[model samples]
Target: MASKQASVASFVESAPPGELSNVVADIKALAGNDASLLQSLEPAFRKYNEEQYATVKLPGSSEAVIVSEHNSMGDNRYFDTASQTSFQVEHSSQTASAVQQHPLESSNADLIRSLQKSFSKAAAEHFPSSVVGIYPTSSDSDIAILLVANKYSPQNFWNGRWRSTYTLSPSSGGLKGAIKVDVHYYEDGNVRMSTSKDVDVSNASGADAVVREIAKAENKFQEELNRAFVQLSEGSFKGLRRQLPVTRQRVEWEKIGGYRLGQDIGGGRSK
Candidate 1:
């Protein structure tokens, strides 16, 4: 059992982020439901979850800029405050390795080009004036698409992002994908909404088909978010807002008019 635990620890230290879950499942099977070994690996899992998604550490800061809970997408998206640049960490389903690269220069040039064209068309048709970016994963078989838009003025700001990741199957060439939507809007206070959706692109024949399918799914997801926002505004947020303070008192007219109202009731006052 100790040997098993040691071996599992060693493998985790060297395993790719994508395979970590599989490793745990394998250990659970081997241990025959022995919870001790799995419990021992908790720290490792926590560390991996906390550290793997963090890309940039600010100068003079001892910790990562972002720490997020583990999710199957295994994506890292963060904005650097100092440089004011957004960074993404992409993972390839083929290699299970993570890499940071611009999508245009990827080895899968043809695929990236096709995806970019599709993305542009969709963005222009639906979300004008939005910022969009495409990133290449570790291998040549996957791509991550990011769409961001924000409206800000003197009083309020609204920010939203839709991130989609697509991986092509080696045998069938079909695409498997997921989309994550995040919304943060500030008016008199802060309001946030986040949602994840699974995109069914397995039947999609080509890159254009995949993008269309994703768009359809995204529309539905957006509707869900809209409903959620309305509920939050009417329910949770409404209850939390401040209306009036407990200390209540009448207005003092003597200080405002420089004389007591009782002393000068009529239009004719002391000249």
Candidate 2:
């Protein structure tokens, strides 16, 4: 059974021991500001990425001066690869050896789908002047990430137990700006970054409205434009969580099954 799971799982080579220090540093940074976004599940999430043996850090959501979104300069088309899709119930496992692999599990798949739905709905709920997206969904091992591309796209991670927040590499569309993002693993851990900007040039659904709003609200609060980003930021996100305090509440299956729970081809984190 372990062999079968390994055959189906996606695997990546671990970074040399030399890179371990950097990875640990990044995860700690993420834990500092984005703990609430993770909290209960970071431990399990780290376990799933056993190959990496580190919590994947999410990058900052945006650069300073989040200008009015010009018409989406990104492409609108995307393809779903069976191997590339996230949250398969089959994808969870603890790697006995760093080389061990596993398939996508159902719980993980659901998490991806949920986050994707969140991004789609944001277009309307956060409409007119808001931009949203999801990307860099890693389908390796039992670990996966579907980042919500808002002013600050919070990267959502799934082991079996699902958690979301920002992280450095194994990340998709990163936050824009000079602000750096990092995190520490409650379990399996990793850290990454890029010198280039993680521009979301693929999703074009809400481009028109986002563009219009950016044009309309050009010189307003840099804070206002990145409300979702700021709201989901390390400090502000705490306040937002206080209002919702995501406790054990039953979600009407039908609600999530219907339009109330929608997923865009672009990206929505679900599970």
TM-score winner = 1
Clashes (backbone N, CA, C under 3 Å), per candidate, total: 0, 64
TM-score list, all predictions: 0.44, 0.19
Please write out the lDDT profile of model 2 over residues 51-82, one tens digit for every residue.
Answer: 22222111221311111111111221122222
- Cα lDDT computed for each candidate against the true fold: 0.52, 0.29
> Which pairs of residues clash in candidate 1, taking residues 3 or more apart in a chain or in different chains?
none
lDDT of 2 at 49: 39
lDDT of 1 by residue, 126-225 (tens): 7644434444555545555544433333234565545555565433656666666556666778766666777655666556876787678778877987
- The window of 10 residues in a row where model 2 has the poorest summed lDDT is 63-72
Name the regions of candidate 2 deviating beyond 4 angstroms.
1-107, 129-136, 139-221, 224-271
Q: Residue 100 of candidate 1: its Cα lDDT? A: 30
Superposed Cα deviation of residue 256, candidate 2 (Å): 69
What is candidate 1's local distance difference test score? 0.52
